[model samples]
Target: MRVQPLIAVEDIERSRRWYQRLFDCVGVHGAGDYEQLMMPGDDTFFLQLHLWEVHGHPNLEPAFVRPGHGVLLWFEVEEFDEAVTRARDMDAWIVQEPHVNARANHLECWLHDPDGYTVVLASPFGDVE
Candidate 1:
């Protein structure tokens, strides 16, 4: 089974562009209350963007009105430094600058998305040795 992560945002289009730039991916199901984003030449979507207060999902809005309280969306990127560069170019809110993560033994950059989610981009596991 594969795990597909979806986050609720205030503006789908804005978040779509932000994530697309961050991962250099595309929004297959673009511009709506919900969107499916996938990597280039990939069949499955890597992430999903859903508008809050819609979709009728339980605890989606008023039930749990937190943008990204306790969750962290982490992705392993092959081009770790380039990804960090893109994030910086986008003027993204950087939670932490790029650094070697001792626990994971890889490079990582922590950032905040448009919706206040903590998005962590890391190099492939064990890349640093």
Candidate 2:
């Protein structure tokens, strides 16, 4: 089974570019009120971007813009370093610099997407060392 997480953004195209660059993914669903992004060649669950209040999804309204109140959109990236660099190049809001998580024994960087969602890019266990 695959898990696909969707977020409501202000601009579908803008968020699409930001995410595609950071994750090195593609916008398989193209630009619309909603979009789905997938890894390079894989086509399974990855992520989804929906325009705010477009489809009337529960809890996806302008009042709910501050999404990172408690949750995190976590992802494990194989090329952790490159991903971090890509994020920096895009001037993405970095909440925490890249660092090794002793507990997880890997690397991780915390950042926020265009819509203010707390996004995490983590390396595979033991991949850092």
Candidate 3:
């Protein structure tokens, strides 16, 4: 079975551009405010970007409510350091620095995308050592 991530974005266009540059993703399919990104991987991995409005959520007003927060997504990279460096250079919000998570057996880091969704970058221990 394959797993796909459905990410909520405040603005689909802005998020699309950000992810496109960050992950080198190409458009696989899309219509209007919804799109699927073809990430570089052997499996049928896809990143789905959808607007909050599509979910029947009211348009965010400055005083209405704050956007949600938490770990919204995770990604595995072959080169952990290179990926972290690229993300840092792009001014991505570095929520967590890259380090080996001994318990998890992975080298990982965390960053937030334009919409405040946590994006994790990790590499398996086997790949790192």
- Using TM-score as the measure, the top candidate is 1
Candidate 1 minimal-lDDT segment of 10 residues: 58-67
Model 1 scores a TM of: 0.94
Which stretches of model 1 miss by more than 4 angstroms? 63-65
Pairs in clash, predicted candidate 2: none
Model 3 root-mean-square deviation: 3.4
When 2 and 3 are scored with lDDT, the better candidate is 2
Candidate 3: list runs displaced more than 4 Å.
Answer: 40-45, 55-70
TM-score of each: 0.94, 0.92, 0.78
Model 2 deviation from native, Cα RMSD in Å: 1.5
For model 2, how does the per-residue alpha-carbon lDDT over 28-118 read when each residue is reduced to its tens digit?
8776898999887695848888887876788777753366577799999988999999999999999999999988889999999987889
Q: Clashes per prediction?
A: 0, 0, 0
Q: How many backbone clashes does candidate 2 have?
A: 0
What does the lDDT read for residue 5 in candidate 2? 82
Task: Kindly list the per-residue Cα lDDT of model 3 for residues 30-73, writing each as its tens digit.
Answer: 66667788866644647877776564655433323334454457
TM-score: model 2 vs. ground truth = 0.92
Q: Model 3: clashing residue pairs?
A: none
Pick the lDDT winner: 1
The Cα local distance difference test for each model comes to 0.89, 0.87, 0.73
Candidate 3: TM-score? 0.78
